[model samples]
Target chain A: MNQTTETSPRPLSARIGGGILLTAAIAIAVEASTFEVAFLTDPVGPKALPLLVAAILAAGGLAQLFRPDIDVAWPESAVLTRMAGAAGSFVGYAVVLPYVGFFLSTTAVVTALSLLYGGPPLKGTLAAAALSGALWLLFVSVLGLPLPIGDLWMR
Target chain B: MDALTHLISGFAIALQPLNLGLAFVGVFVGTFVGMLPGIGPINAIAILIPVTFAAGLPPESALILLTGIYYGSQYGNSISTILLNVPGTASAVVTAIDGHAMTKAGRGGPALAMSAIASFFGGTVSIFALVLFAPVLAGWAIRFGPAEYFALMVFAFSALSSFSGGSLMRGLAATAFGLFLATVGLDPNSAIPRFTFGSLQLLDGMDFVVVTIGLFAVSEVIQLLEDTEGGQAAAVGYGRVMISAKEFAETGWTMVRGSVIGFLVGVLPGAGGTIASFLAYSTEERINGANGTFGEGDIRGVAAPEAANNAAANGAMIPLLTLGVPGSGTTAVLLGAMLGLGVTPGPLLITEQPDLFWGLAASMYIGNIFLLMLNLPLVGFFVKALTLPRWFLIPGVAALAFVAVYAVNGSSFDLVMMTGFGVVGYLMRKFSFPLAPVILGLVLGPLMEKSLRRAMALSGGDWRILFDSPIAITLWVLALASLLAPALIARKGVPAE
Candidate 1:
């Protein structure tokens, strides 16, 4: 039985997608189970939409589970690296934004992404800096939109 | 006559210097952004919403600018489709077929010119239709109760889900996820928290600007990076930008027919430019089958889809202006922008904000004129943009997207959420899930919930009140019909023209 389990292979992504969805459905249903209103805002309360969403999700998930398998075409390893690196840069930009401010963080991220996109490093840096500077002038200086000037720099 | 008077005043407002300048900038930017391969109309409009808001322009001006981006995109969409054989937006997919064929045949210039002319024809003709039909629909929709609004929104969700993507189940899942996201903030009625998981940042709910930029723009950047190894495109110069007089006369009727077909389909709850262009091209082919070259480098081939798609873009506005419901993903984002601008679009919208409605209608005509002027002499200039390296183009857009998302709340938390949503969006796109329905579900979810609850409360907890009215019943029927529509369309094999 253990050998068969090892040989059965991981289920199709349909099953995994379905499993994740089903998990969300059960979680929402359980969470809605705990929703208590002090006064009935309405007879149905705020529970109705969430319940309806859970129902739709469960139906879709169940259909995927029972339906014929469809495999996800995962990106190749090299391509995966590029995608991960690009996505990570965006997340990293968000974390560093408060500490380093808009212009520096934006310029750095853009330059790295530009280089990854295969531009020459020096040209990419110049272009990234110009674009970031222009956007900062537009947003902060001209448009008067408040952007963080970096807490570290302030201190 | 009443419409004429309204239109005249609309022109008066649109002609104002600031509004006119904004309109021009909108179309110009719309064209420039739409010329980029991965950046379509939805991304262009989504990326600009925060900027327009941060600038503190009037709601009407913002609407004008955004809508200009909406329709002007059709004019620009054909450029890349013809040049690269890669449609910039989904609606231009059909345009790519005969358009690229024309380019390969060395008739790219004539094909582009025909597309521009057809787009202009579709744009001008549909503005008149919008001017005529919007008021009528608004007047009729004034009688809708809360129950009816809920049913109508359901119809919209079903329609977009069924039409926009490959599988019905995937679209619905994306929609369910969007509705779940919509439920993240405080429960409006009882003032209870939901799905927030004890974070103050989630309390005010997901901002559409942040969500949209993350979904449309950020996902696009990731998608582009997956294929970064491709070499640069060789510059394809469209030789000359003039359609022969004889060719224009030949395809004149083709343009008119496509415009009419596109306009009517676009007004329907779920149908947008994709179906409209397909229907228009197939119909024109059938009509011209006697001696015509459709799949070849036929000028009429380029004319039909271009005309249909542009007309459909304008036609989609009718429901939005009249009933306050947007039919497609792009318009759903527009609806969110309008809501953020504090403009509640509904039956009272025309009467209450006549300036907004009429001025938008007027500016569209003016925008179309500018589009023709811009696309005609400057085809070479725009096509040269196709040669721009991905590294330069992709990162610039990503930076713009980052700024837009950050500008929304001035919080790094929103930026993190935006990045998370970007990853989610990237996964969704890979899985062939339709992103539009998700946006529609999020933007309309609260309103649908509110209406459902209000109706239930009004009827003292009887859920049957949702189906009690004839109008609500009709809408419920439409919703069910649209859900069954794709299967039926597939069964019939995409309709024989």
Candidate 2:
């Protein structure tokens, strides 16, 4: 039950403001290009929307840059590192999935993530392998998801 | 009487063996997911939508199941609130106040029973309200033009921003962010690429499901990692799921009053369950006065808020189904689902698609009955699931999410995109921006832009026509007022984040 409170006595506020400004700037830039591309198409095409969105984003970004509020708590660096690892593992699963096959890669990635998330080493590894294999069977074998069954294994 | 006739026909459709079964499944699974800490109704619906599409179920049946879960979770959310003191949705927060007190007082079983009864009463009453009000609103909405639609969308964003909690600027910023994401992909009208950034996948624009899963599910995983100690609730120790007759007598009127007040409040923009429950509970307290036990395990306390929350849930649907505008994160996800299903909900919806409208309305009644029956007798089964180990549960969910993303296009590339968005979602949560508005913007942005352009085209590019109709003017005024009024009220100091 994480309550959405702004005035908690925490030091994560300025950091959040900086992040918002950065994200908003990027959003505005990306949307501005959308506006340009829309104009290049038909005069009344989807360009108007991107342009409108971009303007709003730019305004929000400027507001954040000028007056960023402080109202968040930064988790410990270790926690962030583990989260980063989890993200990386998923990305890795996606990249190596087709080539290495669903079972092996999914097992590897899930285990790696579980370990990073503080699962006991033995339990994490076993749980990841079993969970990944079970998922493959359910979605692929039962539900028919067309998952890659590993060319290496087939060969 | 008219509603009864349509409802009878709807029952005929809902009772069809296939739809009836799907309704059961929807409520069952919805209750399970809703009971699980961190996994709310929205996530459950989004993740399962792809499965329904793959199953190729008929639209009504698909909707029956999904919408069943939507209402069913209203009953289930209270379980955690009463048993574990964890309110999965904002509505359940009120339930936890009196419910936890009852649990501590060793009347947990009675409290749980009262919640189920209150939820059922509120849901039944609200469904009646929906049937009576929806058609009336739809009839009047038939005359709405594109300008009016655009104004309505503005009202939606303005309302959400004002009520999104913490910071108005942050909420506006989140909405703006969502609109930007919506702009990604080929221009629907011109067939020209806009913001594809040379990536082919970008041509289809960002999928709402992908964003939803990332923002709600994956980000939840990241948040949980920060607190690796799993949720541990105090065990329930009540003797039986039976409320005293005296308790029922005291709470019956409170439940009725809460339903009426909550339904009305929920109909307004920017008034979410938080406001609805607060108003209902406070009103009940005031009405009861000295005779009423306002806080010390008052049965009415449980009934009032529980009824109001459920009614507010149904009330929130008015704008979503009839006006294509959502007042909260959960309804925003629903709007996304409708769009994904190729169902455009707007003023013309009722007239153009009576079956979808009336069928959905009828199915809601079925869903409510199913939810009550499911929660009442089968409570023990749901509580057993609470013992599931986090190791198995968390990884299983992640794997399912992976499959869902892959199912979207049957591509690993989508998984990559999902992971990236997951990171972005986690960051957004880490920051203080509201995620619901982003989903709202992404879903509604294209439609809003389309309406704006169409309005201009019809008016020969005359901007003044945007303010022509009284309805449209009123909507615009409300939208502006929603944005400015909150800031004016909180003149103490602006939120920093």
Candidate 3:
């Protein structure tokens, strides 16, 4: 059923994404099949919907893997680097958030991003400080929502 | 008269200081995000959902804040469309045609004025229609049983999928992926874990807020980072921001007609603002195409589309409130928000939660008034926000998104999950898989499964029970019809009026 339709040189990227989806689908299906009960309670239990999802996903992934859209635009390395930096910083923020707390961590992340987005360091730093301070005050004091007070600050 | 009384009480709830302030903040932020090129209402609402929840506002107030963001963005979209020619979403693309042209002709101020005016006309008129139609639809929907509701959800999925843009297969794939995500937590009925993979956080399922933010907001940052060519800053109003009486006279009927058309179109499943504006523009062009300079800098062109798009935006809300089905991606997010707030929208929603239904309706009016107030006299202030370095604006929003995700579960793992979903989202955007259907599927999957099983259980596991009623049958036909609509309409060429 595979069609030789894909004309793009980097069609492997499409296949990779599709393969990931296919793998996820197969894994979900396999996991769902093991769900058991003392007796079948419903005509179609929870397994049915997921199995259907897996089937659809498998078909879709196969379709995509076999015949990828050709006009996929890949970003240049420079732009790709910036995107990676932004994503990496986000992950780093996630990693350090609990330890660094909402305030300092937020300031650090925002400042880094501002610089990445092309802000002067001084302006970025000030904006980050202001943003973090304002968010801390609004969420904590005004709204009375609890955000983590950094361990660093507490010590 | 009864509707009026209900609406008056809605106004009372809406008039409370906190609710009012939330509405103002919602619209203000909505307009700001809506005007920004890369960010749209979906991202804006996604970014705010966690914050609103953390604030511990009553569900109704949170709903009010979110719905404000919904239509508020409609008003805000015009600012960039007219000034910078970068319409935030496909809905505003038509507006940019005449809107940007008018700017070039030194009529940017009046163009902005007419857009706000037309949008206000659309917003208010559609809200009035919503008050009228929503109750009637809800009353009719109260008769719907599980089978009909199931069929209706199917119709929703199909309609959304067919209109999910580009490939039907890709949309289906995205939708299936969303359904798979929906199955991640423990199965509500069987009490069995489906795909948690032995993680504690997976027990409660993926939070829609985190998923939505990851899918829309976080991915957007990655996409923006990849874009080398940035938009030029929009010039503030050059001429009078207020349009002349002559200009109003010229476009008065166009605005009214566009509002009517937009509202009608918006009420249909998947026929959203993009179609509404396009329809309104074409209709107006047909009517006055003889003498009017239709394309290049015509104020009526701006009025027609802006009115239709805003009206359509409000019109789309009707189904979300009354039928528990959303007509567009934005409304899908709204539906998700409403569901998260513990409001299951359906026929009984009006009777069950009059405050939410009427309060939201009333607040739309209040929100439109605020949009008018903010956009007309204060257009200059909002425009200045555009001049702020993109570096600052994008990152700041990204930080807000991060904080919002962290606030959801107070876990770094969720942030990691958000990051992972961001990558998935970025890939989905690249592969042209429509993101909204994934959301619709994720939100509606449980309901779909529940209705399916309930229908079967009611009939002793007879699957044919799903088609027992005429309503169910009709809905099934409509579901199939929706998938066939684009093709049929394309072939028939939108038959003569």
Candidate 4:
């Protein structure tokens, strides 16, 4: 069902998203066409699926471009900052995990996320440390899945 | 007779101490995760996949645990819905209407009791139906050629995209995106790297666990952070969760109808517990007409949706186990887990690996019993768990997710990819794009492509071969019809959502 009563112009965000999707679809098609096969493979080669996917994406993009739904209400800047912080902490955790080890890096990222969710510093860090330790025990000591022990320490 | 014999031997395996213990843990953790806001069965199951893989359990045991979480969550979802007016999952959304109304009227105990009983009834009925129907469907599908399978997958995509409760275009776009993700890394037929972007790790293809955790769990953490208005803790004093004989008698028929509707709807690709519960609630509302207090604390209102959703949860397993096709996102995750366990489910699974099939079926019965016992008497303990501070809980979940993603390939690169998908997932949610179809597309994409290529190869590249067989033609028609069904339903003023 149409959410709005009157026909409103397509939202700028939807148009931009659609344009990106369309461009990606063309790019996929072009890339797929260049997939050269050395010998005679199956009747439908690897490119068939990608080309089909490109066509479907193009159709979706064209639909969005012509008739976009209502504009999404993006979160306020404060909330956005928190989300970005959380995402950044996750990326940072990945980057530092090998250097700082699982326990330290996991605790840091979890504490960072906790603070973003309004937890106090002292308690958040404690909880994060406890959680990270417990996970290490479970994954390493119990299940015996090998997690990184920090290249810094290993060296 | 053969099915009964298999089920008997299955019970022998299910009753083993190890399988039973895992079943208990599965339902217990399932209830806990399902009752919490923002953490659903999908996240719990996804996060546990790596652990299950590491544990090196038999395929049957793994399936038992994962499917326990699948159905057990249905029972747990109503706990928060009734007590806090917060639905634990989308399937529980309808339950909140009557369930919370009952709570407001000081009848929360009876409401919770009715929900448990209804869930138990619906679950048991659907499991029986699953036992009876799976074999018949598998036998029928045994004749299906690649063309038929290709068409069936198309039907699944169309049904999911149309029924995912959004504009069809966005759903299609999401599905395309998932399929595109599936096409990443090395192509299955050829060794060509299609979209690896010159990365070494990309050679293995995009792992479903990585994508699932990122899109569902990681995005969930981000979304929860955006909402500053934290939910207030629910009161635990709801008296004993027991219903009167009269109340049970009144809801007996309601539970039956809901179970039937839920099971039938769950068998179809795309529609799951959410739609099943809605249909059951509306049907009961219409049947009651003027005399019914459908929305305002009616006991039947509580019974109808709870039963339907639980039954629908169990009903979803039939396709997953028998057809190797998942009808909903949760089942899609289950299918992925099944694949990871080195068990391929299809028509032959019943005949070939009867132990796995029957063992799972038997464990479901045990799992449902565990759910009833846990929900009926020990629900207070669970309600107290709802008071777990969001700060501790959310980050804990995130850490678990982090471990699971890292465990996928033991590479930090996956972690980076996970964060990227998380942002994309958040943006998709903001724009009202459904995420389930994306998973469905990702899980089913490879199979669909293989089927298409096989079918085309058989016909020497003739496209019309796709429509050659009667079954293939029928599936094509069904796919086209499903795509148009939502539009027609909307035109008739039916609230499809």
Candidate 5:
């Protein structure tokens, strides 16, 4: 079995693409193993589809290993840092959502992302907050969709 | 007499003030969504599904709006392609060849006008074809059995994988990944949750809206963040939006033929607008080899693919509306919208819901007319949008995406889920693991599984029953060929244009 290439000397696009295929292959294997447990129930239950999917994924993974062509450029350090910051902002939004409400949390996250992407601080923050507030009103008030309105502040 | 009468009745429904208004909104939003780099038609359809649902529009009206956006975005995509050299969607990739070249040559005005004219030609022509062909396909499909449908779906999967470029194996894997994502929630036939890990949210399986938003829109935000030193597209001088009569006369037939071929190919599952444009452009290139300027700012080159892609966009609607089987990502979103609107669009739909079918068909004609009118006069206004700096546009789009995602579930948790999918989407893009299949799998997965189980039960567990009917056999063969043909052909051929 040709082991999936973890790192590539080629462009960043190829390396990233290869890495993803590897991750996908591994994820499928894990999902497939979980699916095997379903066989203990109904004889022809849900497991068969997962197993078939796993086999197809494996075949595709093997194909990539053999004849990879698309080149993936590895992201620069600053880009990686920005991506991490974006992720962090998302997590922060989730954590603060209930306490602060959708408006505050989303504004904070969007502003954080804009800053990470090199937007000027004051302008980005204002734009982010304004956008978040506009969406909250539009979805909640006009559309009648229920959104968390923060027990702490709204009450 | 027959066609005109039907078309007039269609206009009755389409020209209803409310329906006309909705169609306008759909195309207007579609153009904006398509102009943004990385957020394609799929994202627009998926994001808007819930909003339309919440608005409580009638099923036919809702469909009119959604379907309008579906094809309208195809026209919107070229704005960016010509101005920025960034093909926002796969179908527009061909447009960039001569489009950007024209811009660099300072003929941006002519290129922009030609794109609009070609698009208008493609749209009008295909809607006529749709008017002619839809009922015929529906009539034939009505005779098909569940077994035939199961096989047809397999063909759809195979064709998509084969045509997805790079390696067939990788495409199949991407398809499999999509199918796997589809299996995440609950089995439709059996109520047991398959991959949900006991979460109530998974009970609905994967929401196509959530997944699509995560995959396309959210991932785009991450990409924008990475390109810190992003390049802004120089806005071209707003010249004449009208194509000179001579120019239109030169490529008029090419546009007609391209539209015909593109519409037909687009009706099939797997090969969608992307293939249609590629096929049309290559065919035009071949036919006009010497006389044609070909790649070097050939007006025919622009006209053919632009017309074909637009026609193909309308063509893909046939399977989605008539058969309830979606062959592409955007159509998959449309199907989801249909289901959400409580309209089951299938073989029986034509006979059972003639008004819906005829009304949607009519609305499309009106939508195209509106698109032509909207695109030409307002081309300058939309082109001016390109002048906005990247730092502003990218972050602003991301903010809107975040709100759209948040709008769906009204929970920050969905935002988190969206972010996770964004990362996955970015990886999928980087790896060339065809994102469309994931969507195809997610949308078609339940249907495929239900068909499989039903076929098995009918035959008392005989697997061969799937291949029993001639139609089934043919589809299976096509599916197998779709899986193999790309590897054999693409392995040694020129890189995908």
Candidate 6:
């Protein structure tokens, strides 16, 4: 549906994605080549699948590079910033989870995401806290799966 | 008679309190998530995989719950399509054309009722067909040697790549990336690690759960964020979810035809519900010719695609259960869950795990009944849930995803990796790459590699063994044909899209 006319230039994003894929294929092939084995355990060995994958990736990358798609609708900068913020919170939650404990870190991340999605601060925090407590009860108390107690609290 | 007897015994398992309760939960949750935008059954199943594992349910019970979600979502997807004009998944896309048109004409209630009935009809028909055909297919598949299995996997990869609704090259690339990820961790044949990069965490390879959640659920979250403008609130009142007898008469034959078409298409690798529904809709349109209101809110229009997709969902289970090769993304995830539950689905699965096989079949019947009841009398409740603010709903889904990803191995590092994948998945979506092929390749790659190496080992490194057998050759031909057919169709100017 988003076909480009023959005269129109291809989207830069498509070409960039193609180049990256091509580079990845080369990297995969190079890494696969180094996989040496002293004994013949199987006729194909470990490298076959990866090499095959590399070849497929190379073919796809070349095709994309030569003939790129017409249009790719990237999000606006503001939307991108929100996405980055959400991604940042996810990474931060993982990094600090062991120290901050599941309840606190989960609440923080959810609240952060809620704000990004445009919730009122008080309502978002309340909902985040409620969700965090519910998850803790379900996973830790009921399911018997351990959630980190936070070294900060344990200490 | 043998299948019937086994099915009866399966009802005993399906009727058990725990299994029955799980089936209900699965369908209920499936409907809720499926009706909602941005959280399709794939995300729901992926997020629940770790939770299901943690709960320690038996393999059959876990499967009943998971498969209930699979088909239940098919029924639920139509609700949003009819109500909000938002088709939840690709399969539901065709439904919106007529479904939303009916809603605009104040016939939304009848449309919803028609969707429920048609879904029920389609689901039951396909399940019956599944029971009849699966055992027969399994009986034949049991004779497949390693070479045949290798060819079958290749066919799956090729068919999925070709039919995944984009350029074949992009689909192939996605499949290759998934295969590359599968090659990470320890090489089972050799003691060497191929792509671990010296990390202890990489030794286990990519946990399909983490990868799936990241690719589907988390990426969905970021993608949803792209459209920060809140969606239009669904209209609260539909007179009542009921269809007149005249309407049913108009749609009865349509449903039967749709179910048959859907089941056949669904049995093929990669075709799945989207194509099945499209084919069914076009067929009905052609049949109606000048006499049909078709896209302008005809009841048959609503019935056709809904019936076809629901039937296709069940039809997909045949290949997954019999051959242990899933044709679509959702079924592929189900296969991953089955493996995680210690159930190896193959030709022997029916004989060895009758309860798992037959019980699943029986529970589908119950799940369909539950979906009907939920969609009909309680349709208002789900529509009400549509009005919930995005801030509360989306964050809630994100939180659930985080817990699910974290629960997989209980390591925070996986959470980080999930974020990385989420970003990658977002880019892939932006670039028009298909995500299903990636999951298919990741799930099937190891088995594909194992079958290939085993075939070669048996033949003492003879490359020709891959094409030596008739079955293998047939499968190879099918794979090649699937790849080439699309190109040929496009050349004919028939508008394959």
Candidate closest to the true structure, highest lDDT: 6
DockQ of 4: 0.52
Query: Which sequence of candidate numbers ranks them by DockQ, best first?
Result: 6, 4, 1, 3, 2, 5
Better of 1 and 3 by lDDT: 1
Better of 2 and 6 by lDDT: 6
lDDT of 5 by residue, B344-421 (tens): 888888778877888898898888888888887887878777676665666667766666666676666677777888
Please give, for residues B345-367, the per-residue lDDT of candidate 6 as tens digits.
Answer: 99999999888899999999998
Residues A1-155 of candidate 3: C-alpha lDDT, one tens digit per residue: 11123435677787887787788879878887898742355777778888999898888788768886635667767667777887888889888877888888889988888776667899899999998998888778987777888777777
Tens-digit per-residue lDDT, B1-497, candidate 3:
99999999999999999999989999888888776767777777887787778877898899989988876777777787788887777778888888889888889899899998999999889999999899999999889888888899888888877776667677778788888888888888888987887998899998887898898888887787754237647455558798988989999999999999999989987747878898899999999999888779989999999999989988888888888878677787788777777889888899999998898889889999998887788888878888777777888788778878877877888888888888889888877788888888888888888889888778887889899989899999998888887777677786311
Off by over 4 Å in 2: A1-16, A19-23, A26-47, A120-130, B289-296, B485-497
lDDT of 4 by residue, B1-497 (tens): 98899999999999999999999888888888777777677777888889889988989998888877876666667887888777756678899998889888888889999998999899999999999999999999899889888998899899888888878878887888889888888887777898887988988889999999999889988988766446556465676789999989989999999999999998888768888999999999998857879889999999999889988988888888888988788889888998888998889999999989999999999998988887788887888887778887788889999999999889998999999999999888877888988999999999999999888878888899899989989989999998898899999998777
Model 4 agreement with the true structure over A8-61: per-residue lDDT tens digits? 343887878778889999999999898875335478888888898899989878
Candidate 4 achieves a global lDDT of 0.86
- Residues A8-34 of candidate 6: C-alpha lDDT, one tens digit per residue: 344686788888999999999999999
Residue-level lDDT for A117 in candidate 2? 52
Clashes by residue pair, model 4:
none
Model 2, TM vs. native: 0.91
RMSD of candidates 1 onward, in order: 3.8, 3.4, 3.7, 2.7, 3.8, 2.3
Model 1 stretches with alpha carbons more than 4 Å out: A1-11, A69-71, B230-232, B495-497
Give the TM-score (0 to 1) of chain B in model 5: 0.96
lDDT of 2 by residue, B277-379 (tens): 8778878878885886567677788899888888888898888888887777788878777776778777677768777777787778777788778777887
Which model is ahead, 4 or 6, in terms of TM-score? Answer: 6
What are the lDDT figures for the candidates, one per model?
Answer: 0.84, 0.76, 0.83, 0.86, 0.77, 0.87
- How far residue A71's Cα lies from its native spot in candidate 6, in Å, is 1.7
lDDT of 1 by residue, B29-72 (tens): 88888777777888888888888999899988888888878766
Residue-level lDDT for B418 in candidate 6? 97
Point out the higher-scoring one by lDDT: 3 or 4: 4
